[model samples]
Target: MQALRIAATGMDAQQKRVETVSNNIANMSTTAYDTRRAEFADLHYQQLRAPGAISSSTGLIAPAGIELGLGVRTSAISVNHTQGSLRQTGGDLDLAIEGRGWFEVTLPSGDPAYTRDGAFKKTGEGLIVNSEGYPLAGDITIPQDARSITINANGEVYAYFDGETEGQQVGALQTTIFVNEKGLEAMGGNMFRETQASGAPIPGEPGLDGRGAIRQGFLEESSVDVVAQIADLIEAQRGYELNSKVISAADQMLGSTTQLR
Candidate 1:
């Protein structure tokens, strides 16, 4: 009976691992997506005999204790915050961070949200916003008469008018960095919110003071690797099969005991 329960836990853990791997594979094309991994810890051990105890018949101390692990449990599903590759989109609004930072956006509820997906668009009112229509924190707006828009590596926005040769400065962009970027909570819509574990958001200009530079006309790709995920999936499948075999063996032994009567 104990073996049955222990094997069941293993199956459960493997099932979760499969799910996590599948999710990562599914988001391989998602912009600025981070891959997550399932971490497990072994359950408490059942100590049948204590080490150094005198043997009943031999009167000799035991060298090692008899311990059996109960099972395994998922401890955490941590996300990898490593930077993804930059992709050229050829769109004026598309942006990518070359180092470390997230774009600040104002959610509908007036809350601040952070995102690495810089596929921005201009609203009807000329306000710069992400695909979800959330406006950027700096509220950068383009003029109607502007012929073209230019964003530099330092997060400066400029608008060029038709008649004049010189470009006018519209607004500046800013990026937010977290003390623990992995600790931020994913809020869907390719956005994240600050948590206690993530610490407070540190606002900084792009390409300055350790902040990432903004690359215009580009976007960051997803961090998931399909080849690696497939390998992990195969490993998890084998683990699940082994655990099932353990349960089957335990059941067969139990059946033999019943036939002894």
Candidate 2:
């Protein structure tokens, strides 16, 4: 019965692992997506014999203890913060971070959200916004009459007007960094919100004070590795199968004992 329970827990854990791998595989093409890893911890143990106990007959101390582990449980799911490769889209509004930073955007509720996806778009009102129509935090707006827009690697935005050789400065973008990037909560839609674990957001100009430089006309790809995820899926499947076999074996043993009685 104990073995059956333990095997059941194993199966549950492997099922969770499979789910994690499947999610990573599903989001392989998502822009600025980071893979997540499942972490597990062994359950409490049942102590059979206490260590360093004085032996009753031999008058000697026992050096080792006997303990049986209950099972395992999921501890945490950690996000992989590894940088993804940048792909050039040639779109004027497309942007990407070359190193470590996030673009701040103002949500519809006026709350600030951070994102690594730089695929920005201009609204009909000339307001710069992300794919979800959330305006960029700095309120950077493009002039309707601008001939061309230029964004430098240093996060400087310039708009060139008609018959004007020189481009006029429009707005400077800022990058936000967190002390614990992994602690940030994923809000879906390629956005993240700061949490107590993530610490406060540190805003600064791109390419300064350890912030990543802005790359216009580019987008960051997902960090998921297809091959590795597939491998993990297979491993989890095997683990689930092994646990099922253990349960079957335990059931058969219990049946035999009952038959004997």
Candidate 3:
């Protein structure tokens, strides 16, 4: 019975791992999508030795009994933080983070958020925003008739209007860092919300205080490694299969025991 329970637990853990891998594959093309990896831990062990059944007195039988395991359970799911490669899109609004830092922005509801994806665009009001139309945190806005938009490595935006003497600074971007970014809770759309476990957000100007420089005309791709995810998927599948086989073997053993005279 204990073996059966343990095998069931193994199946459950593998099922969860398989689900995680499936999600990774499904989001392989999603920009800035982070892959999740699951972990498991063994349950508590039980002693089956009978009370007052020791051999010190009778010297007949030993108090030996197998220690049964309760089962296993999911321990954690760590988010990988490796930076993705920058893809040159040649779009003026397209941006990529060159190092460790997240572009701080507010959600459509004005709630503060952070994201590694930098595929930003301009709204009808000429305000710099992301694809989801969320305004950039710095309240940076540009003129409607601006021409020749340029974003420098230091997160500064320059634009020259049709009749302007020269390009002017129109956008000033900032990034934020956390003590533990992996602990930040994902809120979809490649955005993350601050959590107690993540610590406080440290806002800094781009290219300063360890924040990453903004690369204009480019976008960051997803950091997932296809080969690694595939390998993990294969291993999880095999583990599930082996657990199922163990359960089948245990059922057969039970049948044989029932047939004993």
TM-score for all predictions?
A: 0.95, 0.97, 0.90
**Global local distance difference test of model 1:** 0.94
Alpha-carbon shift of residue 79 in model 2 (angstroms) = 0.6
Screening candidate 3 with a backbone cut-off below 3 angstroms (N, C-alpha, C), the clashing residue pairs are none
Give the per-residue lDDT digits (tens) of candidate 3, residues 128-183: 88878888898888888887788888888898988877799886787888999889
lDDT of 3: 0.86
Score residue 231 of candidate 1 by CA lDDT: 98
Worst 10 residues of 1 by lDDT: 49-58
Question: lDDT order of candidates, best first?
Answer: 1, 2, 3
Model 1 misplaced stretches (Cα beyond 4 Å): 51-61
lDDT, candidates in the order shown? 0.94, 0.93, 0.86
Question: What's the TM for model 1?
Answer: 0.95
Candidate 2 residues lying further than 4 Å off, grouped into runs, are none
Q: Write the per-residue lDDT of candidate 1 for residues 1-261, one digit (tens) a residue.
A: 899999999999999999999999999999999999999999999989877878678798888989899999999999998789999989989999999999999998999999999999998889999999999998899998888998999999999998888789999999989889889998898999999999999998999888999999999999998999999999999999999999999999999999995
